[model samples]
Target: MQATFLIYSFLYLIVLIFLLPFEYFKRPASLRKRWIREKFGFFKKNEQIETFKPKIWIHAVSVGEVVAVSRLIKELSSKCEIILSTITDTGQKIANDRFKNYNVKVIYIPFDIPFAINKALKHFKPLAVILTETELWPNLIRIASKKMPVILVNGRMSDKSFNGYSKIKFFMKPLLKRLTLLCVQEEQYKERFFNLGAEEQKIHITGNMKFDIELREIHFPWENAIAQPVILAGSTHEPEEEIILDAFLKLNITGSLIIAPRHPERFQAVETLIKRKISESSREISFSKLTEMPSAFSFKSSTSVVLVDQMGILGSLYRICDIAIIGGSFIAHGGQNPLEPAYWRKPIICGPFMYNFPFIEEFLNHEACIMIDKASLLEILKELAENSELRQTIGNRAYQLFLNKSGATEKTLRLIEKVIP
Candidate 1:
């Protein structure tokens, strides 16, 4: 099984090298040696290696996974030298920022190629490799398991991902067996992992670490900060933004609309859409140029939209929002994390495609959230925005739900401690 995995890894490496030109042209900065060293598995000789031996290596694929496992990292840092690795630039930045004060080293996980993965493992020499969510790198898992224990923390297996993995059951069965322990987010996820060849004795329901994140009070210092009741369309995709803008336009209330796109590259696109739509509206105002101080309710009826062109602020923005419309659901991206807004005690509105978050969907169905199909979003937003009492009622229910689900972090940490030798 290991030999076959190595052969596959070698073939995958050849494919990656063959497609290097395309990746280089698409993102030259991303493929730079220094950037690759930091973001990918490539390491630099000049870069100083930490003197302290890292006891555990934690891998989070991107920003969402990083945010999901951050609290657990904090807890594990005290007893172990945590080595954090990410696949994206944004995830690396967040990991570095969050772990700067701790005894943690942040690096990019190398390609799943055998040589790259082996090189990284030999250098880091961690006691265990801890992967967040579903980052199942075949070569990495196979090689690391031969040297040190590999554990999956805060694991979640969506039905879609499960079906995809099940097709390659023969290849993944051994990979799943390499995991020393599997700390999953939910029992449903445990069952999914079991179906995918995970050892049932190794699986534990640790709950969702996202529910474990500590909600910090956000203070927006902008002069024309959104003071009046605001509705945030967070992590919206291309067509979803237009839909949200249209819904906000038909709303009966005089409040601000904040649109936060999921990807940073989409910032400009979202900004352009906001400009075009607001220009056509009769009483539209953009908050991007709000430079001067204004009374709390002064710009209540003035600014119609605020495009959050920055990243890492959406979670904070949710704290002050009266209602939240989670994006990606309407357009079939399986939806962004609705738990972020739910933590703020704000009433959430999402489209129908929420299979990625089955537990959240179940909670919403039980009145923990407000579900709106694409066709009904406009009417629901209009109703919620017009009635402050109704918004508050739902918001309070969502907040309670968030509080009820708050112990996942602690539960996850306990499992990590038990496995992290």
Candidate 2:
């Protein structure tokens, strides 16, 4: 164990040192110092807690994982003192805003080095560690597990990840065995974990926590500002936007179109692409940013294309739109979550590549959602736009499926209660 750790530490330090300059320069000027300090296990505030409850450390890697466990954190907050750590700056921002009222201390995760991990563990002094999804930091897991439980909640293994991890099963087995318990999303994930050296007895299929998300009732100005028959191309990637925009133009719909790119860094580039495309077209399509419009502004007779530049509002956009187009699937990128739109009973459509979301297969089997190719996108959109009854039928089916899969959170919490103490 010592030898493996030594080799791992050597390789890890080398890579970290190599990437330090690139990572430092990539961050905004104001956040560079804070990001560097936090990653090295230095925190600004040190306070004492008066509560007698056991302290738990929860780590989520990024936005998706953070949002998946939002409600779980809320429920756990009242039960214990919580130290929530996230890797990405965006995830940290969302967690802070989402859990501002709760007793959660949001911070950046420490680098996976012995000294850094030791500092974090000593400072937090948590009784147990709850990790979201597939965050398998070797040093953190190995060290923390020696003292307390290191549990994985809402765990899943995609085909891509499974193939990659399978190649290094020798290295993964020790880390997987160190985990006291694994609460996975599905039966397949349990099988995958077992194959990767997690003890079968220690792994449990607890369903996905995302199904139990407590959606906020958002009231945004876009709700009233946008025109009717609105089509939302949500969580879109590169070429998908171009395809959607071209399809909308060909369909010549007289309603609003909202394109929400997946990454915040791409907002300006997407806006430029939209403007260039609109300028070249002969049609009188107007384009604007969602942030710039007044609360009560109305679109003219021609078609309107609005770019969503903000973060954490995709759920609200899904609620107001008439038809939803799931992005990322159009390209090789796996699809985004469809549950948000399903929660609002919105008719959903996506491309063929949805391997990231294995549960989507069930939706397709039940006829709950529509899956189309790039060539057929225009036809499907036009059909759904014209046929209100078809849209309602599909939306109702998706909503029913969503309700049927709602108890994962309660099951996971019950399992956590058994081991947390």
Candidate 3:
């Protein structure tokens, strides 16, 4: 092994060993054994790939990445068998659910330790490995690149990520060089990759695959169950829920509030917080869970607040909502996707910290959505709730922008075709 690879591998194993206990215990009891087994590169006999056609291994870190690359995976499935690996349990579940029909095998990504990575690579023997966004696992790239093409699709580099990577340029440069191609989301990401020691010729601006989101005509029973105008706070995090709940309570007009937190593990915590906050308040807002929708649940005459304890339904829920308050922005968590609501032609609201998504600037320039501070959230919510005309105008603009920004998936697929072994 190269000296840099040796050093990184050693350090990575040491860290993994130290954190194994915490990582193992933090998972739910149901997933503990499977998580540990998959992390160490063990797979069932049926999970093994034995395709006559070429096999492609694609790694997406979480739900966002998995969703971003879903279309590409579908396109590739017709050409090659796919081994789709993800790090988070949610990502694994969604990937499995999304590609169950396609020629794709969804599994947890092996621990970055050399032994696990080698075991995985030897077993799958993929023709090419594609990583979504900024997943630059050193051992995985270094080892896999020597055997097969390792490409990065829909790549991006945030300011924080660039600064941290720059500090370790000596270590990162070699890994970046080893990547057969880097298909970035924008010109800024291409420039960042160039600065971080990736050859300029190797980086291509293929646009963001997330832009080419395939919005389905999904109909859930909640579509007709709720009578009040719904304020869906999609993908909310810790303190953002508090802010959203407070803002919803202050709205003059009556409306239901839906809080869909980013992580499923935090569902109970957010539900408890919502119940406590509603109990402490003066208004009569009924609380309920989304799983009871369409049958067991009924919206109270007064304002109703619902906690989304389910997954894979937020995008569909966007169609039923009046206004969408994006989460993760208010507290510098770098905002979730705003395009889902934009696709449904719903007025969107987010905070000022959307650096993770550089394309959000275009929305701001066009005044397609409302980006405000935490203190201004209630004020903005009140205005949107009261003004139907204003909501329609903003929602229309956002849908137009979304329509204009598609075709990224086609662009990325053409580039991948060139590198496929």
- The candidates, ranked best first by TM-score, are 3, 2, 1
Question: How accurate locally, in lDDT, is each candidate?
Answer: 0.78, 0.88, 0.88
Candidate 1 residues lying further than 4 Å off, grouped into runs, are 25-31, 38-40, 45-49, 223-227, 289-301
Which portions of model 2 show Cα errors greater than 4 Å? 45-52
Clashing pairs in 2: none
| Candidate 3 whole-model C-alpha lDDT, 0 to 1 | 0.88
lDDT of 1 by residue, 1-421 (tens): 7577768877887898887666545554644665555434556554435666556889999888988888878888887787788877778777887778987888878878766787777677788898988998887888898887889988888777898999989988878998998988888899989988999999998777787766567666653456466888898888998998887877746678878888877787877887888788877565562223234424444556777776676787788788899889998788888888878778889898877677776667668688778789878877877788888788788778777777877876776667665
The true-versus-predicted C-alpha distance at residue 200 of model 2, in Å, is 1.0
Model 2 lDDT, residue 189, Cα: 96
Q: lDDT per residue, candidate 2, 107-222, as tens digits?
A: 88889999888888887789999998889899999999999999999999999999999998988998899999899999999999999999999998988888887677778765
Tens-digit per-residue lDDT, 192-292, candidate 3: 99998898898998888887777667777555667567899999989899988887887756778989999998999998999999888887778888887
**Model with the higher TM-score, candidate 1 or 2:** 2
Candidate 3: where are CA atoms >4 Å away? none
